[model samples]
Target: MPERDTIMRELHDLGLAAWFGGSMMGAVGLNPAAEEQGTEVDKARVASSGWAKWTPVNAAAIAAHLVGAAGLAVANRRRIAGQKGVLASTLAKTALTGAALGATAYARTLGKKIELASSPEQEKAKKAEKHPISVESAQGQLRIVKWAIPALTGGIEVLNSLQGEQQRPSRQIWGSLRRLASA
Candidate 1:
């Protein structure tokens, strides 16, 4: 493989790692931690604070994924024209990444709502059983983003293998890429 190709692969791998890790952290660590820290009334505030703290880190991870995706696109642009599987994989990754981004934004908005409810005036609003939106929505959005990372990353990996195959002279693209990566 060319040095540029290898470098691009490494960057893509790094981005995948970040995307997966950040999603996992938000879903498993931060969300759970916030839940454990507060009562129903205060839960949103707590969760929001935790997520707010996590925002910059998550942003960095998403940025890494974007950079890696750009690298992959640049490296594989020529080969993608002839590879149906590669094209499909790319499309899948793009869709999943977009979903993850949307979910992240939704989670952030929910977090902000939680923070808003933390105020003294909002205390009265909180006491109403159905007034504050269900925590389930926030949790669900986070879950969507969390699962999306792995699904999308996995798709990218498959796509990467297909791209690698297209570069080879004669070996079957999918099988060869998998074998080479495994070895």
Candidate 2:
């Protein structure tokens, strides 16, 4: 048996958990609540504020997840290379991660656009000042980008489950055997 990458596993699981949960909550709860704000401008402001607050923690979680995933990949390089289905799943996970990252970055970018576009005249950020977008345009972009993160991260969790099952000793043995038989 191999030594467990315990820390890496925890970081990977926890970070992903936070990432998924946060996106779900924002989509299901925060965004909906923000939509209830009296005016359209208020709605966008509330939503952008909620997203802004989450941005730092989300970034940290994403970073932690990536670091943990890299450590785990290195630790499990042999299994990933030799075990049947593992490589395929890992590749799939990687693709999902990439998509999630892109979606996250895009959403944050939209958030910044919203913040800039919606900020009170007196409280504008310099960067946002330089690139002016209409509040309606920012809101429109946000609406479209909203679902991608949760969906991508949710797929990652599903793949995580599959990968978890693949780690069973019997399954490992069978997978490796299948690989060997096919070689």
Candidate 3:
């Protein structure tokens, strides 16, 4: 752990930054803006289009973050195991990261559900989905789920900050000492 993992840290930070920013923007900016459209179909189309546009970039961000997180874990394995506070933060981060991923994927599924449900052609819709859900229902679910993404990711960011703090020389010294004492 003597050597710094600058690249990994950069990737983790930049990726999480984009993920958090994009989710917030979508929740506050894009979704509400899409709501101003004249019709439900239009709203769905607008929101879905915006999310679709961002999907690839978001995927890249998540991938980068996961890779960086793995790299960082490997780099700081000793600290994570030996430091008093680091293990708890690392476990919490891991759980939050998994939850965030699930929330993101679920949001996307709900988005697509509403988007397709908005189609006027009944036969086509039925063909696409055997039991197509109501647009209202799908949207209702989406409204709640979308907010979870930012919340979960934000929690992960806070955990990241705590991890950073734990790496400080003073914190490291105390954390290690505390770990040894507990043993």
Candidate 4:
């Protein structure tokens, strides 16, 4: 049995790496830099600008990851269906990906609110409704949501590791036998 080509695996890994690294850098570096610029409003503006610049690249990375994930899933469907724990772990990873996407969206929404609230234009401020909470409160929530993106993506990384281990020939055979024994 020869090792298969790793192009899709590399794509998946690189995309996840970017997602995790970018989120972490934003939370750690960008946010703090924005905090240092000046007043709370300026902080929001600075942070929003940085995030706006990152949005396209981040989106691309996510798209690549989704495509790679689908390719891998389709390639390994038989193993996933037959292996003992692969199905559960794959489902967990899928759920986590959904949660990460949701968190990222929520963070962007909070960021837009902050951007508007901090804007100089009265019309823009009026257009960007904070809803149910004040701008300051929204900022607090945004902090949590921003951090959560990295956290959830990091969990996906761990799950990816587990999936890799499950693919080892010995483990695959053991898992299949275990499934048969249970049945």
Candidate 5:
């Protein structure tokens, strides 16, 4: 096939950058700031508000990343099918992305629970959906899941680098031969 030019690479890299940076900033900056600025009773509310504001942007970033990934996959179908290790790495990246998405969704759910539990507005608190677990327990889980998001996304970045390296002329030639022999 002829060489195909696309902006998928830029989209993928920039989307991942936003996702990673936003998560890290929320964990390190926004959350701490909320805790410090708000009263004891309002800390969770403050943090939850900030995260709520970020949710839409984060969703967009994740969507862009997924679209770019699909585009790249379609463009490189032959390479993925014929290159040794490429298929494995692609599969691993897919799984990691799914995990990251799940972590993000779970953390958001936990955050919402904390927000309701901490709010002074009894009506709002009452309106919040009940979780099977206590708000305190969800908070504890959120603390860990929040950090896991950035870590998993960072791992995806590393895997992306490996994929780029594998595209090198020498690596591609060797990978193709290895793939052929194994087949």
Candidate 6:
């Protein structure tokens, strides 16, 4: 109801939006495109090249989301005392983010392996398949990362809502202070 509350709510909303948008783009847009492109050997090269080019953009997006989340956490710190539900949600989100980070790193490592071996001959492919370090593993890792993004993003949203609820009282306090000063 108070201005500070409104601002905190808006900050929480912004964090949720960034988390959702980044995760959806990574899952639905980037991962799918990479999969489709990686089907053919030449296409896989092109796809990897394209992804390499986009790495900075992806990193920027991720960094922005992390920064936003941290800001939201700071804003909500004081209000979390009476909001156990919100605190729980924030903790869950933090845990999910950490898991997603690990999964994402695993997926990237697998992708690099696939890229490095992109030019193997049929016999080499077969040999590699026998002790493969590419497609299947990469796909599995990507799948885990893909699902993780959404799960983590959704958790962030819940955390944001909880944050908003917790900050409501502080917002009122600030508003009351302003009103008293004005009078």
Mark the regions of model 3 whose C-alpha exceeds 4 Å error after superposition: 1-4, 119-128
Name the weakest run of 10 consecutive residues (lDDT summed) in model 5: 1-10
C-alpha RMSD in Å of predicted model 4 compared with the true structure = 2.2
Instruction: Summarize candidate 4's per-residue lDDT along 52-127 as a digit string, tens digits.
Output: 8998998888888888898788888898899999999999999999999999888887887888888899988886
In model 4, which range of ten residues has the least summed lDDT? Answer: 1-10
Q: State TM-scores per candidate.
A: 0.66, 0.91, 0.92, 0.92, 0.92, 0.61
**lDDT on C-alpha atoms for all candidate structures:** 0.64, 0.86, 0.88, 0.88, 0.87, 0.60
Tally clashing residue pairs in candidate 2: 0
* Global fold similarity of model 3 (TM-score): 0.92
In angstroms, the error of model 6 at 70 is 2.5
Model 5 CA deviation exceeding 4 Å by range: 1-5
Candidate 2 lDDT over residue span 1-183, tens digit each: 244588888889899999999998998899999989998778878988888899899989988899889988998898999899999999999999999999989788778877766677655745666656655676677777788888999999999999999989999999999999999
What overall lDDT, based on C-alpha atoms, would model 3 receive against the true structure?
Answer: 0.88
Angstrom error at residue 1, model 2: 10
lDDT of 2: 0.86
For 76-172, candidate 3 gives per-residue lDDT tens digits of: 9999999998888999999999999999998887787766666677864664375456667778888898899999999999999888889999999
Q: Judging by TM-score, tell me the better candidate of 1 and 6.
A: 1
Give residue 156's error in model 1 in angstroms: 4.6
Model 3, backbone clash pairs (residues 3+ apart or across chains), number: 0
lDDT of 5 by residue, 1-183 (tens): 233325777677788899999999999999888879646567788898899899999998998888889888998889999999999999999999999999989898888888887778887677565667677788789779989999999999999999999899899999999988988
- Candidate 1 residue-wise lDDT, 25-143, digit = tens: 76677667767764765666676666677788777767876776787788777555444455566777688678767766765666565565564575644643344565566556655
* Candidate 4 local distance difference test against the native: 0.88
